[model samples]
Each structure stands twice: as C-alpha cells, then as structure tokens.
Target: MLVLFLIATTSSVGFAQIYDLGGMYTYHYRDGRYSDWGDFSLHGSRIAIDELNESGVLGGARIRMTNENTIDYHCWPENAALMAETLMKKGILVLTGAGCSGPAVDIARVAEKYKIPVISNGSNASMLSSAEEFPYFVRVVSPSEQYEGYLINVAAHFGVEEIAYFYTTDAWGLGARDVIHEYTQQRDINIAQEYSYPRDTPYDEIKSYMNKVKQAGIRHIVNTSPTPDTVMIFRALHELEMNEPGYSFYAAEMISADEAPEVVAGSLGYFAPMVELVPSPKLSQFRDALEKRLGKPVDPSSKAFFYGALSYDHMLAVGYAIRDIQDAGESVTSQNMMTYLRRMDFDGTTGHVSLVRGTNDRANMPIQIVNSHGYKDNGTTVDFVSVGRVDPATGELILNEDSIVWPGNVTTPPKQ
Candidate 1:
C-alpha cells in the first residue's frame, strides 16, 4: 500500500527520487550554555525528514540534519551565511530553520543571492518577509509583530492598564519589544516600566528588576524571554509574592507543553500567534504512525515533532512545486523553487500557509491563549481563549463574531 502520488501524472513525470538531500542546521545566539536543548528549529527539521522517510514520500529519499556551532546570537547572521555557503557548495537543496530573526534574514539574503530556498521555523520578526529586503524567504510561523496587536487587545480585553516589559536581551526579544513599544505608543499607552536581563542571567541580578516590576503599580506584564528565563521569572515572582491575585502576565512564542507547567501555572495568562488546535487528519495519522515507530508517546512540544512537521510540509511543498515545473519540462533549480513557493498553498499541521512580498507582510493566523497548566489531548484539561481575529492595520483585535470566555478564569493580582 505504498503509493507515491505526483501532482501531475504524465508519461514524462516519474516517481520523485530522493537526490541526496541533507542538511537543516540551526544557529543559536546564546553562549553555548544552552546547547543541550539542541536548537528548537532543528526539532521541526528532524520531524520533517523522519516523516518523509517513513511515509516513503520520496521513496526512501535521505535527508540529514546537522547544527552550526556558535556562542552568540548576533553571530547567527554570519553563521547562517557560512552554513548556507558550505552546504550550497555541497549541493544541498533546501535550507530550513534559521533559529531567530537576524540569522533568518541573513540566511534568506544569502540564499537569494545564491538562489537557495530558505524556510524559517522560528524567525517571526515581520521584516523577514518584507519584499524589498527578503525575496527568497518564507516562514511557517507567523510574524511576531502581528502578534503584538493581539497582545494589546488581549490585555485591554481583560481590563489591563499598567504593563511592564520583561524581555530577554536578544534579537527576537529586542525586535518584538521594539515593535510592541511602537504600537503601544501609537495607541497612546506607555509601558509603565521596562526591565531587561540577558540570557542565562542569575536570579540575584533580576531581583531589582523584579522589584521595579512590583513597584510599577502595574496590573499586567508582558515577557519576551525564552523558556529558562521565563521559568526564572515565575520562580522570582513566587518568592517576591508577585504571583498573587490582581496581576497578570502575557508572553509570546514560549508555550510548548514540554516545559514544566509551573512556569506559567499561577500567572493570569500567555499568548502565542497560533497553536495547532485543528487536528489535521494528516497530522493525526502522522502522529499515530510516529508513536508506533518510536514505541512511546511523543512529547507534543518536543523539537522532534515541531521540526519534523515543518520539514515534512516543506518537502511536500517542494515536491508539488517541482512536479509543477517538471510538467512544463522546466529545470528544477533553486531559483524556480523560490518562484513556486510563493504561489504554492496546502494544508498542514500549522494551518494554511502562503507568502507575501515584504517585511511583516504575512497575515495574522488568528490567536489562541492557553489557561491550563499544560497542554493535553483530553477536552476538559485545556481552556482556550480565542481572542478574535487581529486586524494588522491600525493594530486592533476585532472581537470574533463568536468569542467564548471561559468561566472561572484566573484573575489579575493587585500590585504591592
């Protein structure tokens, strides 16, 4: 029952052959301290390759995943240029998962100059999609800037006034903080106080900042730190007694169920552009088959599934695009793949994905907030807040035609 379906079945068309595909390396910015987590981008990349191999999508096409060593995130742009150059020289077909915004944009520039196809797993800054700058880049994740509007509306909807910005000192956090700051100002709201800490910061160093957060007389907080820093913030809040009622916290892009729920447990809430709630029959079948293969339940938030799903969809897109060009007897080159990607569309785990020609040019794929301590398959455990569709222009969240407010939700804690 192994059938390889081509987009267009023609006599000239043939079952796609895996032509020595490899690579999918991640470049991290933090000093090598967090290397053990491996790159989150690599997780989605691995899942794509593994699923392809198992499903016989390419009829046993081989794909290799690797990593680029770097101690700093700023070095990612240069590191990405280096990795793309080395791999392109070796004839690697696709480059996916540039860990964050700077590196992702850099990789896209390099890929375009050399005509290599680059897809992003994490680089959500809107600028990457800007047509004037990046012509060869496409990311499965929605732009982080668009999500800010959702953040503001979500906060406003909950009657949050005073807000604090607790962000990591990195490209992703800085970029988002800048965008959210601009929008919030344009809307006539100022951040009560802004606090920052570097990655791998000691808890002692954050105490004063935590005190400032407590003293801001603010009722809400917006954090842009990664998983570890996020955990530390929550732990600090507990010790500082900042987790009590009358205060709430909002975060973007770090809601994987893999992390201990305690990080966000007592907080009011957190937000991300999207979470894959709509189970794709394709995704479910893939999940079931993967569980059977691994002989264990896969961590839904594990890098394995994220990168794997991204990579699988990436290749599937490539496969369809290639078939389209091949039907016209056109040569399958990086340049043509780039052209096809802009026009190709299909359903995958993340939802409907497409491309536009400018930085921050991508559409906001609806919003979902989690109120639970952790994600789950059971219906009763997870409480979802669909905060209406975000109108990117003017930075406003239009209440959904039918918004559902969960009963007995967590309330904000009063500031000391």
Candidate 2:
C-alpha cells in the first residue's frame, strides 16, 4: 500500500513539464523602464498562456519567458548567435515577438542556423520570408505589401481615382512607399503626387504637399508612418481644415490604437492587416483572467495577446512534435524535429497551421481596415472590415469580401 502511494505521488510530480520560449521586445524611441509598446507584445504572450492553461492544454506546463532587448539597442549578428546559444542551452525551441525588422532578421538568421523557428509579431517584411535570407522565420502578421493592395481596392470603392503619397524617410516608410508605388502603377491608378520626408522633419512639409494635393484635386492620401508622425500630419490637415466629403487618408499598423482615432477625429481611415481575436469565447475568458490578475481592464489596443498567442501556438507545435517523435520511438534531434514541424498540422487559437512552401513560409494572413470614427482614446471599437486574404501565388490579396464593414467587439460611444 505504501509503495502504491509513492508511485502515485511521483507520477503527479513528474507530469508537469516546463517549456522556454525565446522572445524579443522592441519599443519606440528609448526608455529604460517598461515600454507601453513592449507590453503590447508581452500581453499577447501572457494571454496565450492564460488561455492554454484554462483549456487544460498546459495544465502542468510552465513557460519561462525571456525578453531580448533588441529595441533598446540594435543587436548585432554575433549577438544573435549568442542569444540563440543561451536560449538553446535553456532548451528553448522558439523565438517570438520581434518588433524591429532589422534585429528581427538577425534573430531569424541565428534561429535558422540553430534550426529553431522565430515567430514574429512585427509587421511582415518580405525579406523575412525571402529565399535568400529567411528559412526559419514565420510571421503571424500579414506583410506590408498587402496593405497597399488593400487601400487601392478600398479607394476604388470610394470613387477615389487619384491618390497622393506621403511617407517618412524611415525604413518602414521607404519599403512601403516603394512597394505601394509599384502596385499602384500596375493597377493603372493615377498618382497625384509622391512625397517623402525625414522622421524629424517639420509637419509643414507634409502640409505643404497636402496643399498641392488639394489644389491638384487629389482626394485620397496615404500616410505610412508611426503614430507620432501620423498625428502631426493630421494636425496639419486639421489646421488647414482639409476635412471634406471626399478627403481621406490610409495609414499603416504603426498608428497606435490609443491616439489614432482621437488625432484624426472622424475624418480619416486606417488600412492594415490585423489578427482578429475579438469575439472569441476563449479570448473573452482570458481577458477576464487578465483583469483579475492585473486589477485593471486590458487595453483594447494593447495587442496583449499578440505574442502570447504566438508563444502558445509555438509551444503547442513543439509539444506535438515531441509527442510524435516519442510515439515513433525516434530520438528528438533537430533534424528529426524539423521533419515533424515541416509536416505538422494543428488547430490553434490563431488559426490553422500549414506552412507555406519554403522554410520561412507561414500560414495565410487576413487583411482588415480600421476606420476609427466612434472610438475614444482609452477604449473604442475598431471598425475591422475584412479586406482580403494574402495570396501566395501573387503575394497580393485575393479580395472577395469587397466591402464587408463590420463592428469590432469593443466600441466607444459616439461623442455627444
């Protein structure tokens, strides 16, 4: 009887397992303490774990999270190898939540070298999935190239024939501006004007260009920049009273949810590809748990589940791969693990998992537009209209839902 009790106690203790997920958090500008932007990714990972635990998927699993400060200071290629080594030593199988594209690529190189997959929360850059560099990178978020195509489709719907392009000198702006220009050309769309300005340059320049656009009868404006800069552009527009029946602007995902609507008022619209986790029964319960733990409502735009969801899915993939190898009575080597991951299929909260052709290929991503008219600063319902799916054949959107404008799960009351 005593021997049986000992076996039961040992079995209970041995059932629990720990998994480590490598993560990197980048922020805007630079601040020593925790960044609100950084939390956006962390919250994503936390929400994933919370949901997995509740669902009994990770009932006895513990996750050790690590934050790589690539955003604080740009990490070099060598540093990436060092970081990967450290994570590998700790038995980490995945790297998630890289915000900066450059550093994210560095991490990707190291991960691929080590045969560990890096899942990104940052806006998709084709370089991360290119045949040359990317072989182990997977992006949950849709690529920026798709955003340009989406806006083009939406603009056509609104009777916008000509568009003026204004962007920053930053890498994101340059990449997006170039790709969009090419796409617009292919579609036979007329370009009223194209202007690029430095990040620290005056909003006066953007306004000056806007004046030209207005004079030239250009109605649609596409601004590809961060929230701070985007706000300046709109402030300039507001000052000029550029608000008109046909005047509109589309923006990238860099626009912060907190300030995007308030800055633009009801005059502008945003275009980008975002993951829709709202209205999810699993997500709602996770939100409640987060509130109970944090003692405050999770910010709607915090992207609290971004990294969390990616991490949970990453671990789930790893766990299933392990179970498969164990079942086959094969030793779990990196090569064997790759074989399992290559053909692995699992239904995750994020969606289905069927990798694209190459090593860096990820699942299909959807595009949506958020027109923040009735949204407030703290909380607002983001108007998420399904635009299209990312088409692997042409790397463009296969737009079927031409204009299915839908309400977000959370909405701020209209101003009185």
Candidate with maximal TM-score: 1
Q: What would the per-residue lDDT of candidate 1 be over residues 1-416, giving only the tens digit for each residue? A: 12334435542345445443334443333443342123433444455566555665443234444443212243344465766666676666666555456566666777777777776555677566575577777766667766655676566665566688888766666777887787677655668888876666887777678777777666577777665566677666656767555666666644334444444443324454444435678777666655665576765544345545554555556555655666766776777877776766777665565555443233444344433333445522223345455443345466542333221133332333
The digit string of per-residue lDDT tens for model 2 on 1-416 reads: 99999999999889766555666654444323334455645565665654555555444555546454222322122254566556655556566666555456666677777787666655455456573566666655445665656666655655566778877765556677777787677666777788888765676776787788778876667777644566677666666666544465666643444544445453343445555443555556555655666677665433344434544455456556656766787765655666676565776655665566664445564334545443543345333344445544455545444343221212221111
TM-score of each: 0.74, 0.71
- Candidate 2 matches the true fold with a TM-score of 0.71
Shift in Å, residue 69, candidate 2: 8.7
Q: Judge candidate 2 at residue 371 and give its lDDT.
A: 53
Candidate 2 whole-model C-alpha lDDT, 0 to 1: 0.57
Predictions in order: lDDT? 0.57, 0.57
Q: How many backbone clashes does candidate 2 have?
A: 9
Alpha-carbon RMSD, each predicted model: 6.8, 6.4
